[model samples]
Target chain A: MTSRGVRHDSMRARNLAVVLAAIHRSGPHTRAALAERTGLTKTTVSSLVADLLEAGAVTEGGAVRGGERGRPGVAVRLSGRRVAALGLEVNIDYLAACVVDLTRTVRLRRTVRADNRNSDPALVLTGLRDLVKETVAQAEAEGLRIAGGALAVPGTVEDGVLRNAPHLGWRDVRVADLVELPFAVDNEANLAALGELWFGCRDADFLYVSGEIGIGAGLVVAGEVFRGTFGLAGELGHVVVAGDGPACRCGGRGCLEVYAGQDALLGALPSVSELVDRLKAGDRQAMETCERAGRALGVALTSAVHLLDPGRIVLGGIYEPLFPWVAGPVAEVLEARLAPMRGAPPSVVVSRIGGDAAVLGAAGLVIQQVIAEPGRMLGL
Target chain B: MTSRGVRHDSMRARNLAVVLAAIHRSGPHTRAALAERTGLTKTTVSSLVADLLEAGAVTEGGAVRGGERGRPGVAVRLSGRRVAALGLEVNIDYLAACVVDLTRTVRLRRTVRADNRNSDPALVLTGLRDLVKETVAQAEAEGLRIAGGALAVPGTVEDGVLRNAPHLGWRDVRVADLVELPFAVDNEANLAALGELWFGCRDADFLYVSGEIGIGAGLVVAGEVFRGTFGLAGELGHVVVAGDGPACRCGGRGCLEVYAGQDALLGALPSVSELVDRLKAGDRQAMETCERAGRALGVALTSAVHLLDPGRIVLGGIYEPLFPWVAGPVAEVLEARLAPMRGAPPSVVVSRIGGDAAVLGAAGLVIQQVIAEPGRMLGL
Candidate 1:
């Protein structure tokens, strides 16, 4: 089948990307192991590794023993320090940015609080642009090249456009048009899930629920975000928890948002942290609110478990800090309602990346692109 | 970059399977198209197609024009009639069996109604075995060879074992031991969804809700049944529709099953068809019951759409004939509740395969295996 008329350069480029992916996803492999695993010849593996090293996509270290055969051999791993990406986020209450490298590690992070609700999209983009540019300069000063970038907006993003952000009162905001960097736009929850998948969690399949002013979730199936046909897969907040409970902003009754959204749980409270503080200080109302929110979340997740069957549910954003107060009730509802055989109900857990998951995940998306096509990133 | 010690026979066998899949997925292709799509040489595709024809896995026909190109050439298609599979189902009230072929076509079907509720697992399997044997004999007399088989039970199935069938009063029933065939066991809803995927519907992603004595769903994502982390993904019946509506059999409050299950929807009524007849006669009580059930189902699907974001929702089993009475209220709920940006809620539709979806889908599973590895089916 001698390449079947395929271009030699493109084949080599694909092989390079494959080898890089092998190292990035469970790496520190010796050249011999990579050759065997990838089914490429030892000579070809050597040539590709040489190209990768020259491109600073991978680094080879001294003999790394204690493996399948326990024979000492030089090890190769990701040299992600050389290439990084910028992640920008515009939330209702804040604007954030971070730099993530090829190894899927967060290298720099910063957040600034602001009253962004009902603010003009252009004004918000100006503030976000400043934050991202400064962070990119900082990352560059540390000797990292910006390979690609993405912005995580708390909205339904499609074709690099933020279609809507209810909390921010934004509609059809194209952040890329205003931002200086060539960053694409994406949904916040989706990026956070990607961040957890790439940087924090070891499991490939799980649900990452990002709790902000509005609750949204990212359905991660088979290691990729399960974006629906319309690319708007996870909108957990809108799922009806009670068929006749209460009126919701989305013209729905008894929606999870009406019960478990930040505003619902924290009325007039500045932040989730303050609510936690009140609960810790033995405030009965705060404790009741947390319990009620947890129960509502559990009801919504019961439907999610039935529909998606994710392995685990990671609560990110506001839910992360509030996990101690919420996870117990969520798990309780799951155990009682879910059929005993759906396997064990999905284990509820906190996002290890905390509130910064979305921003870091956005940067991780770029790093993913770089690792998936190293030749393209390195100009071949 | 040769074969890397991979066996020549294995590679050729894989190439044969690849060509067969190409035809089965989107077929009636000329040899040139097969070669182009599979990245195999024209000579290689010709050799593989020759082997497939020899194995009776494909049929070469007269010139079939009108395709991507209006050129005239002999077209290759699935010779599924040569190898068929037996699909058996054991639902709460009936046992069904069907024969499906490599082309995913149902050649024959039969159903026997019985009070399977609270019946002994052994007695039920015996009846099912007899039905399957007769179906196999009938299919054999029609010149079709049974290559493989599977059983769809109204319960949880894992590793060819019926772990539990609550409606059937069965637990740990290993039907393969009694059925004199190499029949695998699977959940009825999962098989029904697969049946719809392979034989009825063109779309790959959908939620096939099988409304029976107990409502269950098959979550089809990326053309495969998404058995959750625990292989019990589409337990839509147990998904909380009303957080505090009523105590359910699963010991949960406000489960969709409590409101939408067969017994709940029909009560003293005998069957869904009877209810439809009553509704046609303008029976006020019947119409009210269906509307209420539709509202409850709509509430459950709202959660499903928000979490899974399936492109479509297919209601099978009893819901097929009942679609006229229920789909309106379901659509109305979706239109009212779902966030406008989640990209228009999933369109609700009836199952094209009618009530026999599970049995047919079960057979399609075996046909899929045959197409995937034609050599194995041919005892290579």
Candidate 2:
């Protein structure tokens, strides 16, 4: 009898998850539409929606007009005021925090520029903590309850530990220990990819290339980041682009980072803004530098495309601003190298969210948990 | 009322699938063990097992004693004799077929050497058809029923249509139309990886490098082949290893295939066998040729490792025979190039299945379908 009761409960939970996922993905949906989408009966959908409404996870959103000459149905949506997720990101030069409601609306956002490289971990983390605390308070003031938080660090993170952030000169830092909130930590590139999936293009599979001081990529497959077996996937910066080019800090020759990383670009220009301005003014030197970087990036990305075969490639961070100058060379090299038999080349686009992608994606991590197990978040 | 009935049937099917998967993965289990593993009650497991027995999908073995002097329980296993799957392959130089029982035991295997480059699709397919027919007849003679067949071709395949086998000079050939069987067709590399998963190490994620006249790769993630958006992932041969080296047939400079492909190796020797013999005899020219190829392969593979981060890389086809000479340089470059932050390098191993991986994998595909929907296989 106990086993049967457990089985029944699990079935209910599974049904609840399905209904929640359907509404979350294609929301403003009527019960009838949800039933059709999830293959649940209308009655089952109604019962689940009622349970979610009572749990404050969902709310009715007026009437959704049916097709012409048909009766209208009441629309339902995830409740924005009931719960929120906090996102935090620590980059070499900035610390950012954001709170997003259940409907993925930004309730609070804060960013501060501080050279964190070579700084004490305690000092850097303290600044980030203050920002997160402020955001949490702001979100609560907006009548939103914080469900959880997640941190995005520019480094190799595993199980909430920031292991070896080369750019920040930090190693083996327990991120959760520094922040008082209950939070999950992941690599910034990984979160950026998730951010794109959640808020940007919502592509089922693509490579999210995050360009900062160094270039990294996040492999997203079926709407989830494809973290390799040990969470060490998508390290695109060090992919050798030229066998005999310049040496890279990673102790490799002709790495993609050496050719296209921010430091490399800056070596040829005064600043990124200046470089962009010059390019816009049709400066020959700036154009040549950007084009060379683009081609090298294309060379490395061609390898990525061949290996992963993503449907699209989203350029985030610095690349987003540099895309116009880079896209042509990147496409030319990719077309030249990728097998003609592969039909069309994968689409490459600039990230819509830009620098905020990692922080927003960090919030998405919490939202993902709530979606996976709404009962836990609802305390049911 | 009808919807409730449909839901109930689906629930039953789901439970049946769970039980079947458990047995298939870790079989020869007692009813109690199945209950513990599947989280189903002993009574529920017994009933499901009984149904499976009635459907001839499972059979009881002799009772096995439980640990620590407990009462013995009857052991159950899949009924291997009740079903079989056929596998077929069309390579650049060979056509092969294999049959395997549900227990993954090969019942019949055949391979015929025939250069298929620039060959007429109809004639090549006819030769393959004859080989498959002989294997099917042999399997039936051994008292096994052919569940289905899958064909492995070396090129881009989409929905059983060969879009372009550049090596074979074939285009837009519908494989199913060429064969009269309830069959599925896929790229040779994809099948080889699946074959490795089903019969070799069974790593949840790995890159299976298929080294033939041209190089290809199969990316497997979480026990399934990761075919990119359009099924054109894993074109590893075209990955640029040298930016200014010789031009490749794929219209790329310094592609891995240009330096490591069979043609490249054969260019320096009489035959693969003779090259191996010369290397074994410590011939300087043979050693130099093999070493150069290994380094070039290493260079290309470094790019792959940085991008995908597969848990293991299984060298298949020609690479298997040449692994001893190649593995060293591949490891050297991977270790030197991969970021130290990524922890240890992925394990590299030669495929244990050797040349028969694709054929066995083709058979495995059919078996996989049966395992996924055992009810259909059992005529339930």
Candidate 3:
């Protein structure tokens, strides 16, 4: 293409992205409203809307009344039944898959409980493959075409490879080669944070704590996951809370994981649900254990608050179910340790999306890519 | 402007920014080299260079002698003598100012020792005004225009207001109102980190630890300081390393500053220089004090590494002079506490620019702004 042609095409793509993002974020809007919102001319917005409608990426909705002035304009929204994204997750004890439409609604979902901690990588991948296939078929049957997908791994994932998942006893697993989809892989905690950002609170900056078999944190800055220089950030579990405490699987002493990880909590209580039941029933042992765990979590998070100074801290995974039992102790330490000089302390809240955050976030990754380059997604 | 004119102007500005950034970062280069580097046509590069030359932002240097090529192209470089930036710093015991030209050469420098702790904000601002006047006069006399300036303060600054400076016993001081200048105010540690990034190592990500009367840190990510949601990130001194250790002035127990802050070290020794001299002379008390302080710093930094996973850690301020005696202990604790899953521990080193980092960083802030919008700075 000539330079002029290239520049025109780039401008058109940027305009399409702006229009699509406005619709995706603020729900249905008319072309006139979109033009006003995106600072584009009405002609440009109308042309882009026509292209999007023809591409089946958007659809006309109910008419938007113009306050008894001009003609009522047709409202446009992202096509919910046409395009969908798949989210897959591989955990120590479960394989899960979910499909979300353009409107961020779950179209299909499945979870199979299986102890994959001691399972071979090939076997686990095969199980996850079957689950994904089933979920994709369901979405197709429901008139949704899979735009793209992502995998959430509870491990250090880099360039489609699962480096290590201590809880699953897996290392160096090439997830992309086995998944058989145009999918990207990332740490589950990172995905959970992204999920919270897109589907939970829409906060620009916060710490999303994922308490699974091991504790991990997702540092979100300006609505993006802050992967450190080595892509190994958010290792909250390994932060030493005590100088000479119990050893952690990561070979660190007195790590938060030693006190608050799933294994530690489950060692005392049968299951998270059972612990919640006992806490509601006023069991002294359960209360003490949870308080202690919350304190350890608090200690680790105090360091996180100081380092990141996030606006909020969202507790996900098991912590969501255990928040009622843990909130007091966590808040106590945070209030005491956090610098009072900096306005009010960051608010601590339970994850609204709970356990589904990673799955939702995995789907969000595809949505983000689509929004970033609508022309590519539409094959324009 | 019309839409077409606006688009054209924006495109030109972007192309100019690309060309200017290339020259600033990679030093002088010919038009051909810049075009190739920035992926722009040679004609476009020439046009942009002409504008920059007219604005006095760039100057033609000696002809480039190409090996095995056609007619050599003339080299172009950023004009050094035309523009200068001023840096001002307010600490508990000193007021310092510096001026750096476009090429980052220090043209004027001054430091005045004053016990500003417990002093009135109006009086301190008056003193600072005199110091800044002296520095600016020197720079003006050298035939350099002051493009802009930034003030570094040892406090929680919000929009030019010093919210708190426990060490200086300052709070709610309207610094910008008191001192006249087109300057932005920021924490000293943050400025120090910026200074190190612009002038020292130029690492993409690192923690710049600023050890003053109280310990503070600057979290640098992707060459910019990562001020958290509230612009209060990198409160390293207040991170609770010990739950039951000495109380810190920040109201946190077992903070890194309680063990390693300049005041803590000076409490036992006469002064920073004397302590450094005693450590070099093998004094048992000085060695032990420095060692313990380093250990506490390591403990706090271990948390920092786990949370942010920076590639390197740079020790600045008072820690730079004490690095030789303290590096061993800091490294030992860091190595032992840092999670083993992440390949190797981040390298810890003393700041190359020493105590002048914050002052240099204040100047860097102006340079960054200038680089970001050269057209505005050049009155184009």
Candidate 4:
């Protein structure tokens, strides 16, 4: 093609994305409305809609009506079925995968829980690869083409490389080669935050604390995940609370994880359920332990609140189930510690999506990529 | 004017800004170089440059060197003389104002030292107005026109409303009407961070801590100040240090301010200089007090470092002068507290500009706005 033709095609590609994004964000709209909203001519919008329809990124839905001077017309909606994305997670306790379509609807999911800590990366990745293969096979049966995928790991990730997963004892591991399709790797905490931003009711700026064997935090600022300079910003578990307390797994003394991590709270208990049962029975030791852990979590969050001034704080992982025992002490510390200028501390809430937040968020990231360039998805 | 004509003018106005910003960021550039840099056609760049020149936002200079084969051509530089911006600062102990040209060079400055604590807003503003008047007169004498200005207050500010200046005991003060020129108001710490970004050697992501009577922080992320959800972020002095140490003026107990604030560091010394002299004389009490403050500062910053992961930390205000005595303790605490994942802590440096940072940042902001839309500055 000539250079002019290439430029023309690129311009149309950008306009197609602009129209699709408007529909995804504001729901369905007629071609006339799309043109008005996107500041493009109706003829151009009609051509772009045709291209999108051919690419299976959009479909004609029921007639829409508007207040403006215009006749009711069929609406263009984001209901693509031919394209799908995969989401995978590698955590200390589980390996999971899911397939999601263009509408961000999960088509299939499988989670296998196991003790992944100190496990060999090759063995763990084999399980993850098998799970992804099942998800992709299910997508194929449903006539959904796998466009891309992403892996969410609990570690510091950069450029599809996992620098370290302290709980998993894995470092410098690359997961891109495990999947047949194109994929990205991201820190699970950041992905969890994105999940809250996409799937949960809590939108705006907030911090998502993902607690498991290891504690991690994700900062949602200005409606996006702020990963910081090294994509390692929200390591909340390492915030020094006791200042002279026990050393943590991450090799930091007096870290919040020293008190609030699973090992710290559970001690020799086999499972969190055991501690939950004791708390439910009003066991004094369990109650006191939870309260102490809560205060420690509170101390760490107090510093986080003052430094980031997050609009709200969402506790995930074990904190979600333990919110009853921990919220009070957390609130007490925040109320007493936050400066008067901040009138009242933000509410501490439980995770709505729980453990699946990261995987779902990973799928949504792929959906975002497809929506951003439907022309590319169609191989235009 | 016709609607099409209005759009055409607005497009030109935007293009004018594009050209000016290119010149400001890249220094002197020939029209051909600008066209290549901005991906605009040579004819378009020439037209935009002409508009900027007429707006007194750019000056042509002789420039003839290039790697690519081309004829020697005059280069356009950001060196406007007629249009200047004003910067004003209100602190606990002084009022300051400065006038700067389009090139961000300060042409004149004035500072008046006074006890502004608990002073009436009207009285303090009156003094500020007088100081601004002198600065404006000096600009006028130099044939410079004041296009706009901004005020930096040591408090939380939004939309020109000073919500509160904890150190000055002032609230809900408005300082706009005091200046005749178009102006804006912002938090001092945010401006000081901007000052460091524009004037100091440090660029990219860094946190600038402005320690006066209150220790406020300005988070520079992605090369801009991140003023949290309510534009009230960076209240560092109020970060809880000791869960139950001492009640602070801001109604928080065991806060960092209780240990690290200017009052806490100076104690009964009456001034920072007295404390500095005592420390110079090897006074044990002074050394111990500084050590405590440094540890507290380090603790609060550890949280900030984990939460924001700023690439660097700059200590301004009193910390600059007290660097010799405090840097060691601050570094020690940070080393003991930060996660081992972060191999080494970000270097803690002292502010190079010191007191002039905020005022100069305010001026630079005005200069930026004028450059952003030279057409608006010229009233086109």
In order, the TM-score of chain B in each prediction is 0.92, 0.93, 0.93, 0.92
Q: What are the runs in model 1 whose C-alpha is more than 4 Å off?
A: A1-27, A31-55, A67-71, A110-147, A173-184, A339-344, A369-380, B1-22, B25-27, B33-48, B67-71, B110-147, B172-184, B339-343, B369-380
How far residue A190's Cα lies from its native spot in candidate 1, in Å, is: 1.5
Which ranges in model 3 have alpha carbons more than 4 Å from their true place? A1-8, A63-74, A176-182, B1-6, B63-68, B174-182
Q: lDDT of model 4 at residue B310?
A: 87
Candidate 3 residue-wise lDDT, A1-380, digit = tens: 00221145676776788888888777789888888887777888898999889877899977574546877788998888687888888887788889988888887878899998767988888888888878888888988888789989888988889998877889888988655445799999999998998889888789999998778999888767888776788989887687567777776677889999988887756788988898899999888888999998988888888888788999999999999988889988888777465556788998999988998899988888787678877676
lDDT of 2 by residue, A145-202 (tens): 8888898998888777888888799998988765555579999999999899888988
Residue-wise C-alpha lDDT for candidate 3, range B263-371, written one tens digit per residue: 8787766789998888889999888888889888888888889888888999998989999988899988888766466767889988999988999999999887777
What's the best-to-worst order under DockQ?
A: 2, 3, 1, 4
Q: For candidate 4, lDDT tens digit of each residue in A1-380?
A: 00111123555666778888888877889988787787777888898899888878889976575746656778999875787888889887888888888777888888899899988999999888878787788889899988888889988887888888877999898877777666888999888887787777446689999888778898887666777777878888887675546766656567788889888889878889999998999999989989999998998888788777788899988888888999899988887766466778888888899878999888877877777777776575
Against the true two-chain complex, what DockQ does each candidate achieve? Answer: 0.37, 0.42, 0.40, 0.34
What is the DockQ score, from 0 to 1, of model 4?
Answer: 0.34
Model 3 error, position B32 (Å): 2.7
Evaluate all candidate structures by whole-model CA lDDT and list the values in order.
Answer: 0.82, 0.82, 0.83, 0.81
Worst 10 residues of 1 chain B by lDDT: B1-10
A379 in model 4: Cα distance from truth in Å? 5.4
- Candidate 3 colliding pairs: none
lDDT of 2 by residue, B1-380 (tens): 11221265566666776787788887678888889888889998898889888766678986564645667788888887768899998987888888898888888888899999889999998888888778878888877888789999988898889999888999999887655556899999999999998888777789999998889998787777878767887888988887767998877788889899999977856678887887788888877777888888877887887777787889988888888888888888777766454656787899999888898999999888877776665556
lDDT per residue as tens, model 4, B122-148: 998988888888888888999898999
Each prediction's TM-score against the native?
A: 0.87, 0.92, 0.92, 0.90
Q: What interface root-mean-square deviation (Å) does model 2 yield?
A: 4.8
